[model samples]
Target: MSKSESAVLDTRESKELKTPTDLARKGVVEIAEELKHLLADTFVLYIKTKNFHWHMSGPHFRDYHLLLDEHADQIFEITDEIAERARKIGETTLHSIADIAHFQRLKDNSEAFVAPKDMLSELHSDNMQLVKFMRETHEITSKHNDVATTSLLENWIDQAERRAWFLFETLRAH
Candidate 1:
């Protein structure tokens, strides 16, 4: 290589080239840990929502089924986003039922179908938990100067909180 080229390479190497992931190493680690929790909680919540969507019974079955299905779909999308974010930061997400059970705030319901109000309560609680985790992750991302991830997290938190509020109101109304 020419002397000028070598000098340029040396200068570049000396400068700290940071990507969002690189800048977020510390926050990324914290967020990864939170993602592990959120992944489990959200995934379990997704399954429960799907169950309610499929097996919802009563006068409001159609409306509840469709609505719950929509919520489940949304949660599934967030699940993928959370996993992708974890992968971006070089972290492995929770990957199995057992892992999910260990980490998730939400619980699996296998024995019997629950009442619509009960289902809504469960979903509301899970969504609130997710909101809390996302808010913390947002703060971490802000500190790390990871604007993109922070923005994404803000959106996620907003959506989750909205879902929680909707569910909460539904329960109160019914």
Candidate 2:
């Protein structure tokens, strides 16, 4: 990079972006931090869902595989919205995989062979946890009078609930 561009990048890193919002600076910071953690957890859950989808096997392999693929896609679709919400409020977000590892509350599965049933159960639990996290974040947004974020989170919470419901019903059917 050129010297001027490098200097600009350094300045940007050191300074908070000035977004014109009615929220107090402290409130904005708090909201951004909460969103960052939520984003990290979302990314972790998305990867785990994908992992299960790719590794799914058994007599019902096709159905389980497709279900997880849909779940993973749904989980991934919100990540960008979370990050962008943080940015819209004049705050920085997670910068790398290291940041995600640091802030993520959900655990990753690295086992070589997770059973299909186990995968469904684990993802169900994770989605439920995500709903809890989103609700907590919603409280913060509401406190800050961030209606936009709260609205977005409401949709996300519903989606997570649906994913959990699907997993639960699938488990019950087997």
Candidate 3:
């Protein structure tokens, strides 16, 4: 396809609310909105996880850094799925970095220094919060009868829970 034609088609797709993949319109609308928030949360957490991975220090620096990196990768991996699911249902996915910042419920950490324990603790809390969002998304998807999304969210929750568990155990006092 020509570049202009592709651009035009993209514009049309963005405006469309109907597709062969249609679900109940109302249900899809509601599900898509919640998914956007979930996507925002996921994006924020992914960045924070990477931040912690980069800034981590102290006794268990290597282990903590690697853990955060792995967690960040897992978190980043799901963002596409969340966004694509929205598009599949005839909704526009998150459009830009600002959109993620605007919709995200998670807080960012920009301090120059954070102790290893503090980093672990903060990431743990944020991840737990994400799982809460995932569970809520699960309900929204289920209510909307979007089994594909519901299934994906369940997997997300599991990954989040595992990350949270690792952080929790790592924080435990010896």
Candidate 4:
């Protein structure tokens, strides 16, 4: 095939899939993009949480380790839902770790060691940021009248907030 013909075929193949939703195409695209970014951030956060969980040490070793493991599990659980929601809304989901790296807003930690309190503080900040991102995406979903996505985000937001609260309380007790 000629280059131009191949380009046309590629464009056609890359078109967004049709999904049943009341939202306009533009709104669906916007929400999907937001979900993509949120999913990327969640992935980054989950890894960082696991890193802390694995490296935790000190007088409260067991407690901090277990706490981060629970938080990591919660963070990892939402990733599938976020990606599936994007697919359900007629958009392709992230395909690889490079895509996650491109979309992620959270920073990855590579420190040799982080103090236990520092780990809790950093996690608390990241969880709060995730909550903020969810709220922003929730606004977009609400504006588009995408009730299902909005509902899912509401639950995820609550979970993120709970995680943040636990981190905050743990730090406070330290």
Q: Pick the candidate with the highest TM-score.
A: 2
Rate residue 5 of model 4 by lDDT. Answer: 76
lDDT of each: 0.78, 0.93, 0.88, 0.92
Question: How would you encode candidate 2's per-residue C-alpha lDDT over 86-158 as one tens digit per residue?
Answer: 8888788999999999999999999999989999999999999999999999999999999999999999999
Clashes of each: 0, 0, 0, 0
Every model's TM-score: 0.79, 0.91, 0.89, 0.89
Error of 4 at 146 (Å): 0.5
Clashing pairs in 4: none
Better of 1 and 3 by lDDT: 3
Q: What is the per-residue lDDT of model 1 for residues 1-174, given as tens digits with 9 covering 90 to 100?
A: 999777657756877332234554677777778778878878888888898788788887777788788889888998888888777765667778788888886668884868887888888988897788778778876777767778888888888888898888878877
Candidates 2 and 4 compared by lDDT, better number: 2
Off by over 4 Å in 3: 1-18
lDDT of 3 by residue, 64-131 (tens): 88889999999999999998899888788789999988899999899999888888999999989998
Q: Give Cα distance to truth, residue 88, candidate 3, Å.
A: 0.7
Weakest ten-residue segment in model 4 by summed lDDT: 14-23
Give the clashing residue pairs of candidate 1, or none: none
The alpha-carbon deviation from the true structure for residue 14 of candidate 1, after best TM-score superposition, in angstroms, is: 25
